[model samples]
Target chain A: MTTQDTTYLDQLEAEAIHILREVAGQFEKPALLFSGGKDSITLVRLAEKAFRPGKFPFPLVHIDTGHNFPETISYRDKMIERLGEKLIVGYVQDSIDQGKVIEQTGKNASRNALQTVTLLDTIAANKFDACIGGARRDEEKARAKERIFSVRDEFGQWDPKRQRPELWNVYNGKIHKGENVRVFPISNWTELDVWNYIRREKIELPTIYFAHQRDVITRNGQLMAAADFLNIDEHDRIEHKNVRFRTVGDMTCTAAVESDAFLIDDIIEEIRSSKISERGARMDDKVSEAAMEDRKKGGYF
Target chain B: MDLLKFFTAGSVDDGKSTLIGRLLYDSESILADQLEALQQSNRKNDDGTIDLAILTDGLKAEREQGITIDVAYKYFQTDKRKFIIADTPGHIQYTRNMVTGASNSNLAIILVDARNGVVEQTIRHSFIVSLLELKHVVVCINKMDMVDYSEQTFNDIHKAYSEIATKLHLNEVTYIPVSALKGDNVVNVSGNMPWYTGKSLLDHLETIEVNEDEKSPQARMPVQWVIRPQTDELHDYRGYAGRVSSGSFHVNDKVTVLPSGVRSEISRIETFGQDQAEIHSGMSVTLHLKDNIDISRGDILVNSSHEPIVSQLIEADLCWMDTRPLDDSMMYLIQHNSKQTKCKIREILHKVNINTLDKIPADSFQLNDIGRIVIKTADPLAFDLYHENKQNGGAILIDSRTNLTVGALMFRASVE
Candidate 1:
């Protein structure tokens, strides 16, 4: 890559790398929030760059929904093994069994919101003072207000009004005992940047990210795959289509996009020309305008 | 996309939140659920007109009063640039919040009501923007539609603001008239303003090259943490972990660790699991030294030839953020980079009259006041003039008992 072309991306990468090191240096216990998505996967690569030749400075924590695509889980396991980093799984299913959370009853109910509880519980139990996430600001409105070192109160609530003034490269990670900061190293990156970085780095990802034939049904003008958690009525028809996921979340809510781009170069071209946003096909955010904000304030990653 | 960090300043009725909400809405950055919440909140109000500002001013009290209470950061990106927008409140009482927002910004967007034309708050915001040394400033005369899109009115407002702009002596200044409520000259070029030939706000934002000062002649790397295990696999290992604050460092560079006045040579710049050829500001890496020196957290490293001033006495520009007035005789926790030491306030030189851009001589600094002050730290901290090196010349003052960050201090000059 030419130096000029990668200047902006390199600057962003450098800033992210700085924040990652800060998390390791400032906090007593820190973890990388891994979701097997492209953004988090990109974060994993940056983390590797931040601390390599040795094991990761922090462990990888995944808040499992118990409804993930098997391909994603397999990819997650393989990535952890390849990097030789410790993985800690916090299960929403266990939370449900313990009555910490109640599963919603509906045709398209998701555990996406419920994961917030499990995530907070994990942080409190593990005494993690900082959790570095893969969230990008271009994804949502509420996320746009997030600080690189976002402070959460004792109740795991985000008070946007009183966040510390983050100036220059100096991030003040000072917080009270029970309060923790949600560190987002890639806060300035966009979806296209993530894809471009992946392409340049030749990072490995789940096979579901590429085009493949899968049985899916059209819902809400978006195509969703057939899965165990997804309920299909008798009249609901499923068709085989060449599709790929623009984003990977819980299986019930994330919709696949119609595409034939199997390679990274082709995917980059498709993204450049695509009119719809990355979150357009995701069924979860479509529930309401402030769904992400509400979830975020309640400690959702 | 290139990254641009900016701050927006406007009063309650200047439509700051609406402008941000419109940008997000027109760009399709708002999620489906967030749009639903906006609708639901509007429905609950029983008014057909959707309060677009609710998209940004999310607090319940802010919704009730229709004013921003504090600084809120918002992000959005176009084909060319990614933006980190710090939306600060307009109320006079929240000027400290505005200072906090503008401190880290490379650019500032100061919104003025077209009909009002450079009111008291406009001058106040512009003064603070200038004080912060923000290179680029865009003066957006909003609500032009309310004035029938008159070119004469726009010129009058622009002329009035130019006088203040001259007093501030900013690096670069541009004026644009628009109707934030009607979406003119924000994301797209407005057809109504035919007399204006300049680029739209988004166009300007996309092309403006932000001069991020990462390269400096005097290098500073404040040690944040020390990595020392001396494990069986890796014996005789001592690395200083910190982000490069300024300048560049190469292997075998003669460096001196501060606070202890110990000297050493750089053996390696470790990052990404491998030794790097060189390292610059904003890159966090571990430094291996040729000679093992006694260095720990709160110690700074610098070039031996170009040494920074090591003194306990300092004169600095202070932005007091706490509600309580700073105690002149009390010792405050002075934190510069990762170095924390006790510093007692020697005296207050002068306080800034933000509305007039005048320095009023004062004996003490109060809440939300910008002033010049003298401080004496317990230990000598290596630093330069704030205008020369932002990394070494700045620090934060915290109350010893409360541990609350009270003021941000930048070295004005050395106390000779």
Candidate 2:
């Protein structure tokens, strides 16, 4: 008998690696969805473990909202360069310019929803049979019902009612032409689990994730980063506060929380005691009760 | 902290959702934002308290129907253990959903309303739990407050359930009385039940010793993906990457490829680009064999002396999931572990009536039906019995036309 005891994190890592390998083996053309978030970053590491010593079977794909933080873009580029893998950027601005989608005009206007159009366009154009994502079920109630290998129709619409039953570790990635599967390797992980993994693996993230002085404004009781693209109302007061983002998304919708968790361990400790969910700070989900579900049904990553 | 995966099964109004909500609430796993949203929603119970069932019924249709339709996963953690709860629907029509949720669970929590005692739903759930080979069973007799927290009611229900459990081969059953809405004996000990003395539901979950079956004597590793660098620096790399399904494999262990029976020796074990002396079950790693042989996905490597049964004929118990009845003439795709092969149902021996636990002969199976069937596959499959090793024995049937999973299969035995 082997004397090694498998820890919880180790078991999770194994499960994720197993899923990643299954995707690589099953799909004809697969791509990793890189969002420059901690979950996606951990996914990159797991992919490295799954197919390191060899190049990744699939290229890394990112949907560029054009409202992303500069730090995240730079970090994404450097990581791709270091891994010597290809990166495909699907631009939402390009979709808007091509008249594929209209831009929302308001104080809380975000290109987050428009990313779906560009994403579906890119998937169809590239003929990617499967697109691996870093979505975790513990994040939201809607996602909790998602299968590991979630199948989508040719129109990129998700049917929550008609999902395939995923039994054991065997995943059925079989899909007809024009249909694709969204593979989530870390579907069972929690926010604390992700942070603990990042800390244990010494993974590097963008500086914006750590506590830093940033110009932020309060709106709808959320701390929004005062970026150049953000429209500031006349009554909004901007202040430089020491805050860190619990999640990273389009700069327009993602919100930050007041924290001094400069180090990864400190961030892990903070998340362990956090009363707010990781998605609670995001402004986009607050738009409606089933905002995430609606976006997912429309093929939003 | 340790990890425990459990599933809850009970009929509607049996308080399955309320029980889960109570656990999350008492553990402080429910976030403040979630609590606020629940409070502000108009879907409150009659007592003006926030509807805890709404917390897990995420879909709009589920809320409109006021009953869970599918399996929803919920996570929470205490100081000692992290738990993943698969809150499954209790309706008889959603038995397939219950099977899906209980497939990966180490334990099963069957909720029985104290007022109703042991209903047919309880027997059906316990039967499925036994069929799935779940190790632990917690029979939570909920709604004690409605029964006036009487010890007599608890004892009567407990005695009735013990008889049913014995017939279902559920020996590790634990009965507890509780009121999910009142938070009695769920997360906290109840002062109303002075005659009862036992650990709370959360306390038992926190400290229960999960005894994993001893690793199978034979090591089974199904090749998930073959990693061939083909790079200049690692041109000779031909690594077979997979998770160990059972037992352990070490360097220099004599291994044989299944279906082809190619023999080789493990030269090295690699994990995250580092060489390891050995790899155990549940750990995904790449292995370098001493001799190169024709290997691909769907092939398994095992100890040379302990090869699995490789046959095309198999006997299995299946749970039909699709609305359309399973037809014997149609060919379906049977996916076992990493292997996918075309298969046809050869025969339906008998169907087990979940309510009565009787074996009834049937020609076809409808949705939510559990039956024993014979399968003939085009290719040989190397597998173990479902009672022996779950990872290698479980399989799924996908419809050829719709490409949707139609049924779940557990290998019973190899047919001659």
Q: Which candidate is the best by lDDT?
A: 2
What ranges in model 2 sit over 4 Å off?
Answer: A1-3
* Per-prediction DockQ: 0.27, 0.69
> Which candidate comes out best when scored by TM-score?
2
Residue B392 CA error for candidate 1 (Å)? 2.6
Rate residue B269 of model 1 by lDDT.
84
Candidate 1 residue-wise lDDT, B246-283, digit = tens:
78788899998887788998998887556776787666
Candidate 2 on A35-135: residue-level lDDT in tens? 99999999999999999888899999999999999999999999998999999999999999999999999888889889999999999999999999999
- In every candidate, how many clashes are there? 9, 0
lDDT of each: 0.82, 0.91
Q: How many pairs in model 2 have backbone atoms within 3 A of each other, for residues 3 or more apart or on separate chains, i.e. clashes?
A: 0
Candidate 1: TM-score of chain A is 0.96
Write one digit per residue (lDDT tens) for candidate 2, span B258-310. Answer: 98988999999999878889888888999989998989998999999788888
lDDT of 2: 0.91
